[model samples]
Target: MNPAGSLVESLLPLPVLLPLLGAGAALVLAGRPRVQRWVSVGVLVAVVAISAVLVAGAADRPHVLTVGSWPAPIGITLVADQLSTIMLLTSMTVTLLVLLYAIGQGTSDDETRTPVSIFHPTYLVLAAGVANAFLSGDLFNLYVGFEVLLMASYVLLTLGGTRSRVRAGLTYVVVNVVSSLIFLIGIALVYAAVGTLNLAQISERMAAVDPGTQLAIHLVLLTAFGIKAAVFPLSAWLPDSYPTAAAPVTAVFAGLLTKVGVYSIIRTQTLLFPDDPVAEDILMIAALATMVIGALGAIAQDDVKRVLSFTLVSHIGYMIFGVALATPAGVGAAIFYVVHHITVQATLFCVAGLVERVGGSTSTTRLAGLAAASPLLAVLYFVPAINLGGIPPLSGFIGKLGLVEAGVQDGSVLAWFLVGGAVLTSLLTLYAMAKVWVLAFWRPRDQLPVEHPEDAEFNDLDHEDDPDRRFPVMIGAGRAGSGEESYSGAFLGAARTASDDERVPVALPRGMTVATGTLVAVGLALTLVAGPLYSLTDRAAADLTARTPYVTAVFGQTVDERVTR
Candidate 1:
């Protein structure tokens, strides 16, 4: 083995292992908020660094490690290939910044019944779940990883414990539980059919299965992943649930959660049953419907958060379109788009957090004169907003263009229809963003009817009964918003009463600003590095479609022997 490859292989498990360990440490340090901060943030930073090295080295080949030196097919094997490492790095970077933002929001001292503390440990566990799913070389492990992250998210989602947060959280929990149950069923069916849960071994076994059985298994897996990915007809849960969480929670969830499902879909489609035309056809129709329906829903939304949530669902179609083409270039474009969307979407939500803090509202109808009040805020929102709308020269445009090009190459009528849907979706997204800009930023502050600052009803807030009026609220801080004292669902307690000017002013913590600004910079960084990123994804797609590197790494089988099985 190459020395560099071996080094990466040795570090492959750290991204998952370190976070799991750090979560336990966070539990030990629960009483010390400051120490918990250091422990949690330090673990994430280390995980990102490790994941980055693996992504940087992925072109050489995948790094595979069997835990406890157990045999590959029978043991728990973690594989960090180009796709997995890139995802790991992107997710960790976003999460670390979100954690910093959360610390600024003051979740370190989260008061809950557990006393074991929830925020730091739960957040770290969430990171571990994401990493585990990415590295999992077996189907059952992937299912476990999903449950881990989803459960952690359950706590994060209902932090405030208000009627609204709990209601939304319950909805989230029920939907995910059902989705998970369906996913387990698919796993059982696959295992029973193939007698192995190892993905590489399944690949070998699957090739021998009859076409009817393969199609059945493929649809089962897609159905489970589809609900999680929030594909149309299965995505109604997201728009309602996501907008209810605190800003930092919402930002991370919006950016990272659905993409995990997309990643699973990508793995299954590319590695397990690459040639199923039936699934491809279903993906085609679903992609177009998702794009159109999601965009239309965004246009109908009056609240900034809901609009963004709907857009998030809309753009997922573009990724699915790339996957549906089932070509290397097509999947490559999907990969690139996933990276772009993660950063941009999270940045936009962070900006939304800022908007709520500074403007005292995320409702465009209630917002006014933000551009004048905070030029920096406007700029932050503008960049990602346009990037998301696919304006020229941004990463979004580049990714969409790549997908369209791939669709054209495919030359199928369904691909062409999806291409058209993507274009229309982009135009509608731009319009929806423009509507927000005009209402929230450009209008005079006084032009919008001024309600007394103390009135304190959140138009964008779900407006449920907040039984406990928590104090010490930090609006835009992105933690929890106390009931009857909602500060745009970010800070759980009120800090100090705002004066007339301070109430309207864009005063944010330095840590919060720096973290939000860093993410915006990361989005810009993606634009600057688009070329190299595309090249990397292209190589990843090629390697994935060929399916040689992964099998060789895990099963210790040559390509011909593996294919002949």
Candidate 2:
């Protein structure tokens, strides 16, 4: 290997290692919230820088590192190819921004009930897990990555310890536990059939196995990854689970976790069973179902967070559609869409949090006149909402266009059907976004109908009823003079203050706003750099299709040479 290649390989492990080390440092400095925040932010920034370097270095060939100087097949290996490095860089960047938003939330009056001590360490562990999953070169290591992240997520999801959050966290835990068990069983079956768990070795040995056995192993792994990715039938748990957490927690999870599952599917499918028509057909069907059903579900939701959660599920279909087509254009489009969704989805969730902060609830029935009250917040919401809806000249539109073109190029009956389904899904998504805009942003706050009859008596109260006339009399949990302290647990389960006098409006934190705005700009920037980014994804897709660069780099020989040896 060249010296440059060696240097890149040497840096491959830092993305995973630095976070784990930072988590430990955070644990030691648990009592010092400010110091812990600095540690966490510094660690992630370093990871972002490292990932950028890896992306540049691994563009042409993969950089492989064998842990503890062990042989490739016998010990763990980490490989950074174009696809993994791109994902690594994108995920780390988003993670860093979310961390800053979280810090801002903690320092503000609207501090999350979750302790900063626990939040920092758990969050960093989650970052490490994402990095590990992207770079893992073997099946077991990938499984380990999933477990690490899942464990951290369990903590993050139930952070506030509210009954609703605990209930949702339990549901999330059960579903993931079952998925993990299935993945473990699949790993066992693959090892029993092939003799090595190394991904490159398994790819080479898989062809020699019986066709039936190969298909069986492939289905088992796909089922496991599909559940994790929240594809349609397996996705019912997500909407309930995600909306209950804090804004930062929900943002990071929405942006990165499911994408890890998608990344796994892309890696295993292209590397292990690239020629399986059965799997491709199955994925195509699943993609269509996920797209249509998720969008429809979003339309039915009245809550802001729930709507975004549903749309998140809906867009996963686009990526699946791309991968199912099994062509360079198809895979490249899927990769591009993944990057676009991560940025847009996270930004929208952060904006939703800000809405809850200002409006006291995320329910459309409870929120109105936000544009009149805070035009900046309204702009924050509108740009990404339309982007998610696939408006022209945005990253979302570019990605969908690539997928549609690839489908047309294929000219299969199923591919053509998918193209139609994708278009219909986009239109449905636009409707859903518009509905939220009209009801939550455009409607007048004074015209909002009463949501709870039991609290109607409070609606009749005059200014004289209040001892301190600092703000208007409270009308249930929906109306206040300042529009910020009505405190309904309608969506986020925010706590209500004891007295209306204490219900002064809390200003939106500048750090949180900056973080969200930066993410939104990043989403727009994707459109500006679409040409070069798409070219990179195209080259990455070419590498995934050929599968030689990864194997050769890992084993120091081509698959043919290794098999012959």
Candidate 3:
């Protein structure tokens, strides 16, 4: 422990606490949509501010808070290490942007509920859950954080009540629930084996245990978290469900959820079971399969959102590759990669929503001529698409380069294998993005058609009892633009009357431009600040590798002997 340093603390609880309190307020004010929006934004603003303070504090000193001050290993603790502080900051930024976007989107317009007030409270809870997960120092605390957000997510995913959405949501719910159960069971076994749920204590205890039992627990915990992370074989449910949600919901979910899983993997690997060869070996194999199979699925998907969702799965392998390397440089690269990927993925999803809004259908088959139709949007899609594909100068390329460099330095067969797999995945990612670009943006507009009038009527007819039946009208209008596409009689009438707003000539209501623009600005901020941002990430990575700060913060003392990795 660095006893020479002064203890640092602040009113850091605002990040999570404000959101929780605001959520209750929002639920109480459910009848007032405007009030709900304001409340959600205010909560997010406070969260973002608190996160900034934490990040700044982490730059100077590690910030630790014991909930009830029982002591290390017994009391619940929240430690703002550099990695977690950065995650908190990024989560707040994304959440704020999404909330603004949703505001402009209007709650009544959401397909899920007539009064969109539940979104405010649920989203706050979800954000708070994420902050809690990132900051928690105890294994049991992490479990509670996961449960907190998962319950909210179950509702968010099933927001709209269409048959496809309901079906997809059900699958998502079942898979996540089963994974959560496994996680609880794993926690129980770990506690039984080690006598404590404190992460540092578990790390200390694991060294004294027999290798076989340690290996069994390591594999069990990995399997549970692997499912949460959507690793190869356990990842089938992500693609089936993520694409069906509302765009804002999908964007937030995509940004935060899998990363939470990856965060768990990072925590467990570094803290709980650092030297388990079986776990390392499993990660190596799983990283390859996840990257390959996920990319293949992206290649085969016609839906633009679905393609991106599969690509998200593919990219998770990259982070797993870093964890598998088990080196300072590798871990650093993984942390950097996580922030870059989260922002990039969320931005891409937000843009996908825009694409669907502007071009009518997100299906590659139905989308065309976006480049000519709305060049600004085309720019939006292109830059992030290229970033996701690991083009030079973008953060994605920088992150991947660091990982590959670390792999070369490690010089193990497994590390080399992961490097090769990463390269292949990058190529596949490029191919997938190019497929989207070619099919949706480069094609002539005449090849695509707006929705048929009969189909429009059918959609309305089929979902008449549904809360979101009105959305098809707006969605149909998003499809009306581009070059020479013709619409059915009914669709043409609806499309012509949709809107005169040059920003969105489709089905979207005139009021949403502000919201869409807000989220877009969030993406822009990351790109504009990439220089200073990467520096922060690099420093955070360095701190994350220096294990003493975190250990001392949690336990108030550190062991003299260095633990073997």
Report the lDDT tens digits of candidate 2 across residue range 1-565: 5898888999999999999999999989876667877899999999999999999999869999999999999989999999999999999999999888776553321233456677889999999999999999999999999999999999988875666677889999999999999999999999999999999999999999999999999999988999999997889999999987878889999999999999999999899999999999999999999999999999999888999999999999999999999998999999999999999999999998787766656777656777766788889999999999999999999999999999999999999989999999999999999998998888865566543432422211112233232221110111132243333323221222223212234556576788889999999999999999999999999999999888888899996785699
lDDT of 3 at 335: 81
Segments in model 2 whose C-alpha atoms lie over 4 Å from true places: 107-112, 450-506, 563-565
Q: Of 2 and 3, which scores higher on TM-score?
A: 2
What is the per-residue lDDT of model 1 for residues 1-565, given as tens digits with 9 covering 90 to 100?
Answer: 5888888889988988899999999888877767777898899999999988999887788878999899978799999889998888999999999878766654333354223357778888999999999999999999999999999999988876656778899999999999999999899889888999999889878988888988888888998999999999899999999887778889999889999999999999999998888899999999999999999999999888999999999999999999999999999999999999999999888888777766655877767777876788889899999999999899999999999999999999999999899999999999999999988888775565544636656533544464233222232222354332234433211112343323325355566678888998999999999999999999999999999889988877775885698
Worst 10 residues of 3 by lDDT: 489-498
Candidate 1 deviant stretches above 4 angstroms: 107-116, 450-456, 459-463, 467-506, 562-565
What is the Cα-based lDDT of residue 103 in candidate 2?
A: 66
Give the TM-scores of the predictions, in the order they appear. 0.92, 0.91, 0.88
By summed lDDT, the worst window of 10 consecutive residues in model 2 runs over 470-479
Query: For model 3, how does the per-residue alpha-carbon lDDT over 1-565 read when each residue is reduced to its tens digit?
Result: 4332233354555677888999999899877766777788888988888788778778866778777767777788788878888888887888777666555443343333434566678989999899889988888889999998988888777665666667888998889889888888888888888899888778778888889889888888888899889998999999888887777778888889999999989888877777777788889899889988899899998788889999999999989988888777888788878887787788788777666655545777756667776677777788778888899877778889989998899898888888898899899999999999998888875555455444532222114455333332222111222333222222211222223212234443333444555545555566667777767766765655566667776766676643421
Clashes of each: 10, 0, 4
